[model samples]
Target: MKFKKQIFGFMDMLRFKKLVPNRREALANGPADPLPTEYRTNVLAHRLHPGRMEVELVDAVMVTPTIRKLTFRRTDADAFPFFRAGQYVSLQSPVGDSLVSRPYSIASSPREALENKLVLGVEDAGFFSGYLCRDAKPGDRFVMSEPSGEFHYETLRDKKHIVCIAGGSGITPFVSMAKSMAEGDEPYEMTLFYGARTAQQLAFRDELDALSAKGLKVVYVLSDETCDGCEHGFVSAALMEKYVDIRESSFFLCGPQAMYDFVLKELAPYDLPRKAVRKDAGSCGNREVSDPRTFRLTVHVRDKVCEISAQENETLLTAMERAGIDAPNKCRAGGCGYCHSKWVRGEYVVADGRDGRREADRKFGFIHPCVTYPASDIELIVPVGE
Candidate 1:
């Protein structure tokens, strides 16, 4: 019995020795060559996920007043990168002393990215839109990210037909999809329900009309001025039913916050699955109404508690910026967790629809300072950026 036990022990030792070589090899490789420290930090902490991108600025003539398009081309000499349709790219720039990043959806066919070109449309909004409209020229260079967003027409998930309800600037992505359909770049039949205040504000009208002439169904739902060829009403279920068959079709909505809120109520009548409907990003409806009650916000950065005035209805990041307290933020809408911070003690209300807090972060008392407003005076721990 003792001799048998010794033989079993010897076999166990041999098996352990056989497993050690693979473990040693993995350790020697050391985590797949560790990306540059800056790149790693951005991915984990700053949300600056890096991708090999080609960046160039190309002119896109509107041929109309308020609607202009800009095209970006790949600078890579080898091959251009590809991106999914309805995805967005982050453009980073210095807004005064603070660095800011904004995400814009690609309004070109998915194949365009492979051709070293991706397009985005901007309306008359004075922020980035105004800059793109008035200042962006052919030779100008704009920084951008690889396509990012979940608002694409998926074959496995979405139905055969799609009724894209677009309003104002929200018409961008649909234009790309429509162009793709016309060019046979994508395999889906799309019916666009476009809403505008007037015919003058309707973007890509001629291009859409041409696409429709080739069998792509395009309908303009104008809110003002009943024209001969346009429907005069906001996009609702009844309106959509009049044009496209919505029984098994999906509804893709993109517009201003007020328009989306009203459209969601209008769409509530349709008992379609939750996956059948989608919306895009926009400004948080919580306007900055200054409150008289001001509290001091003590932020611990690099082991120093820097005090700043926490204004009512103002975000902590905004307060810190005003106080010359430099911090990192990419998407100020709170969707990007770049400005995530630990709230030591305080109450805050992140605007509805803008809150993208992870479940674990909520459980652990972490908050995104971009969209979080001061419900009470508080202290927080934040990371300093170089």
Candidate 2:
């Protein structure tokens, strides 16, 4: 039976009078065990987002003359955290006097990651890459950052059909994407356009073809040479129109600066919405100068401060790496903001089109060491490496 307001008020006051007594009685009768020192939620979170992992190279094969497909297994854990299909991981190892790291897209599917297997496609174009491609053998240990990147598919922001364009070693992420689609993890239909100089240079031709039979669309485009049943030209808009309506589909591009320039120029005429296109960032390399000068670089990692020599044409992150200082970095492309540090004092400049810092970060004197070069003797407070 419902009570009137005045009766409810009286009942509440009577309950309040017995509240202390009731609480004491319940406490006395409660279980004697103490509260848990750890939580289940915290344990699951740590398992999924382990920031860094120690991995061992288990296998390495030359997919092409220049690119090597390397497989790794985590030494610290039995299984790696599952990641998005198109995300990347940064691998770090000491090469000679310098401690170097580079970001490479994951070529294995996320399902394979759960089985403690992950793969990377490394092109032997740089000093560290050459070492990894040729010298690194099975059983060698390396530090691997957990899969991290914004280069994956999103259900809300992207369309159902995604047209991917790759040049040279840029086909790495699409390998994972196709595998993920075949595994029923991703919801998007993938159409890949892989462009290379010749038919033999097309890495993963057999694997991509096998996936194509499983519903993924594959197009092999050659520029210098062609074979039977392949598109014989660059990956132009005109060529794409023959198979898919690019304007109605989202685009994912990964390649060199020249390829990006060409594809972007081709799409400019369509006046497509900016969100319709997604391009993976390329790493920043040393600037070309006739005569480069070395300047003093003072770095502060926590309370320890060290001064080293930095080159005028190199980035601050490069100087830190050459000095064997473990400064935190991921993309090394000035994007991701993983290497953002405080600018203590320096005459510096961010690489063109590589500045990914927020406006508030710029206003607060934050700098991304990965893309920033020392114009003069410089000083910075770098974050401790993960």
Candidate 3:
């Protein structure tokens, strides 16, 4: 036993000696350079998930009195990325000092994105829309994130037959999908049900007709105007039942908040599975929450706290903009997650259309201040942006 113990001690000493120089060498070498690892990982991530689609405005055309289609082309053709037909692009822009973002559905088909083009239509209202209508000109550069959103048809999840309900400018995504199907870029049968106040407000009428002539089915439901051949009424359960085969087709709804509310009640009788119904990221407006209570907002950024009064009727982003604080936001509707911020301490309420917070964020008490409102005195850790 003693002899074996001596031999073990000698072996242990040799192992210790081997470890000592390697430790010193490692210490001398210091920390490993992270750049190569980071770069390689980033490259792989880009292959898996492309990033930063910067585009330049090539042209703009007024499609209707309240609608304008802006055409953008890739600044670098070599890096242009592809997108699904019904996806959306979140745009970043500087509105005076505050940076705001808005996401518009890619009105152009996926083939267009592959061809380095993206066409989007915006209603001529609000901050970004006003900026585009009044100030945006040709050759202007627009920074957009990669195409995102999951409103497209999935073979495994969605039915081959689609019943699309659109109101106002919500027809954009369906237009893209319909065009793709008509062009044989996608294989699916679609029945589009579009609502408008009048025929004049119906955008892409000629394009829709052309696509319909090429096998896409379209039904226009006009509310205010009466035509001999067209349907004249709101898109209700009776209308849908008469026009759509609800048992075999999946439903897609895109419209204003009011329309959404009305349609939700209209659809209650269908009793379809939750997965069978989908909603577009609609407008962000608090129509039901009247007489909201105002509160104070204290934001901490870079160890500096700034106090601002927040109006109950206005969005947190709007209030911050009014206070002249540069808040980074894209897609004020809360879908893009660009305006993500940590809530240090506060009680706030995110409006309905703007409550797209992820489950992990809800667990972590993070909120998209762009769509959130101060329900009480609150402190937030916000990132300062242009």
Candidate 4:
């Protein structure tokens, strides 16, 4: 028994000797070189997740008096990253001394992405839109983030039939989906209830009419005017029932805040499952300030501290931007949580239906400045810029 144990111990010692050199060799030489195939796949993955891409405005067409469809072409690459039909891109441009960014739904289909082209419909609403409409030219260069949003259809979660309720410029994403369906890319039936104040305010009417040839159904709901071959009323529950069956359909809503409020109330009778409903955060409504006064704001970012004035009505994000503070932000709708900051000491009101912070974040003194309005003197610690 002693001889047998000695023999086993000797074998174990020999095995350890072999492993020691092998481990030494592995440490001396770092990781092995990746194969050419692996290198190519990694490059492709980076292209898909390229944090930001440079694009140039190739064309701009007036879709309506207030809406313009800007076509952007990739300048640095042959192809832009492919996006789901209902995704959005955040475009950044210099307004003056400060850089501003806004989210716009890609009106172009995924097929167009392969050709390095994407479309965005901008409505003349605020400062950014005003700049795009009045000052932007075809040769302008801008940086846009990769597509992001949860407004798209998922086959596992959504029904085969979808009812889209769009208002004003909110019709952009649905247009992309309709175009994708027309091209046999998406496999779902859609009925669009597009609302506008007048016939002239309805954007992409000609394109939508052409898509009807491919079996897409569109019903124009005019609120302020009655027109031939159009529904002259709001996108009420009664109107939806009169046109299609809602019980077996998934509902997708996009538009201004008022439309969202009204539509949500109207749809309450159905009591649809949460998964059956989706909304674009871009259209979340802004709140009016009861006290239209400006207050002082103290912001601490990284090692620098600055003081600025914030209006009671304007969001903290807007105040920071106007004060030339390059605060980090994306989705500006309070959904992405990118501009989340530490609310050191402040009295503020978060807009209803726009607070997307997790319960833990809310409990731990974090706030999304994009949707938070200052009611009194404020101080916050914003995350340092990348």
lDDT of each: 0.74, 0.93, 0.80, 0.89
Tell me, by TM-score, which candidate is best: 2
Please provide, for model 2 over 1-386, each residue's C-alpha lDDT reduced to its tens digit, 9 standing for 90 to 100.
34688899999999999999999999999999999999999988878899989999999999888899999999999999999998999999999889999999999999999999999999999988899999999999999998999999999989899999999999999999999999999999999999999887888788899999998999999998868978998989899998888878999999888999999998899999989999999889998766988999999999999999999999999999999999999999988999999998879988999999999999999999999999999999999886
Q: What C-alpha lDDT, on a 0 to 100 scale, does residue 340 get in candidate 4?
A: 91
Q: How close is every model to the real structure, measured as TM-score?
A: 0.75, 0.94, 0.79, 0.86
lDDT by residue (tens digit), candidate 1, 1-386: 99999999999999898788978887888877666757654544322233425477767677458778787776643234455566667665444554444566678776766676777787756555666777767876655655666778888988888888888878888877787777776678888888888888888787788889876788887787889889987887788778877777887888887888887887787777899888876644244665446888889998788877887677787777666565666556777686789999877878777889999999999998878888778899987753
Two-way lDDT contest, 1 vs 2, winner: 2
lDDT of 3 by residue, 181-294 (tens): 887887789999999988888888888988988888888999999986569999898998887788788888887868888888888887888998898875464435577777
Clashes of each: 1, 0, 1, 0
Q: Residue 115: error of model 2 in Å?
A: 0.8
TM-score of 1: 0.75
- Sorted by lDDT, highest first, which candidate order results? 2, 4, 3, 1
The best candidate by lDDT is 2
Candidate 4: which stretches are off by over 4 Å? 1-41, 283-286
User: Candidate 1: global Cα-lDDT?
Assistant: 0.74
Better of 3 and 4 by TM-score: 4
- What local lDDT score does residue 346 receive in model 3, on the 0 to 100 scale? 71
What C-alpha lDDT, on a 0 to 100 scale, does residue 118 get in candidate 3?
81
